[model samples]
Target: MLVRLAVIAAALLASTGTAFAADAKRLGRYGEWESLTYTEGNAKVCYIATTAAKVTGGEKGKNSTFLIVTHRPGSKSNDEVSINATYTFKKDSSVELQVGALKHSLFTKGERAWAADPKTDKAIIATLQRGKEAILHASPAKGSDVAATFPLSGFSDALASADKACNIKR
Candidate 1:
């Protein structure tokens, strides 16, 4: 369907690690999350995207912040996690993500952060499904330390939409 293709395209764009506006269709919305897909480079990509419920500290820039779980069929990086931190990270500093009682250390580059490996990505998703919320502690290059909170409500449903949209299992 046209709408489905749009969702795929949007997801692809979201996970691309670059800044760009998407002109795509949304597949669905699950609580605080959204299911999106879109076309890029002739390939379909699906992802679940959400914004933080609250953010504190860190000097302002564009202040564009969000999280994404993306699937690119037949690619090595499928089911990856990406975060837009809204500010460039300190050189060689990692972000700390706390969900419930678990904590994960994420690698950072510029204004983005992500799980260090595919296995970690899967683990983060699993935690997202069962945890209350996610709070990320980060240090920006030019500002004070920051903490961003993202609610876990509807994460499972959002992931299901992404999986179905991209023909991914689990």
Candidate 2:
């Protein structure tokens, strides 16, 4: 777990648009997931993150992909889901997140994708917590289709840690 967290921290440090990741403090690691907290302009942000367990197609091994669920108490935002892909997404495209029999679409912007609304975010989080894995299907701006799989082994624990840190109720 330490090695994996190290690798994830390295990726986070090297990535762009991570908000205040430089000041993020580790909460804990559960399975393949990790929880952290950071302050963004005086607002505390608690989140859980996990890298793609497997990526296939479209420049597969060359991109960095991860899934994140964040909470912001100041804004009353909870269970905000975001998927980050190293490459820019196709213009006006939507990414598909599938977990077990549940499927949802997320609007794309640059390298990130998100649920259409807070309700959708909650739905996605619930699905993720109950499922074992999630598969994201996306189309990049300059490449073929890609599918990234994320294991949900520690998702529940990670989210719990984030929620506790943010003082969010369920």
Clashing pairs counted in every model: 10, 0
Candidate 1 Cα misplacement greater than 4 A, ranges: 1-21, 61-64
Residues 1-170, candidate 2, lDDT per residue (tens digit)? 76666656655555545646667889999998999998878899898999998887666455668898989999988888998777788999999999998999999987789999999999999999999999999998876888999999999999999999999986
**C-alpha positional error of residue 26 in candidate 2 after TM-score superposition, expressed in Å:** 0.6
Error of 1 at 82 (Å): 1.2
Ten-residue region with minimum lDDT total, candidate 1: 3-12
Off by over 4 Å in 2: 1-3, 6-19
lDDT (10s digit) by residue, model 1, range 85-139? 5568899999888999999999998878989999999999888889888988888
Cα lDDT of all candidates, in order? Answer: 0.77, 0.86
For model 1, name the residue pairs that clash: 7-36, 7-37, 7-38, 8-37, 8-38, 9-37, 9-38, 9-39, 10-37, 10-38
TM-score, structure 2 vs. true = 0.92
TM-score of each: 0.86, 0.92
Clashing pairs in 2: none
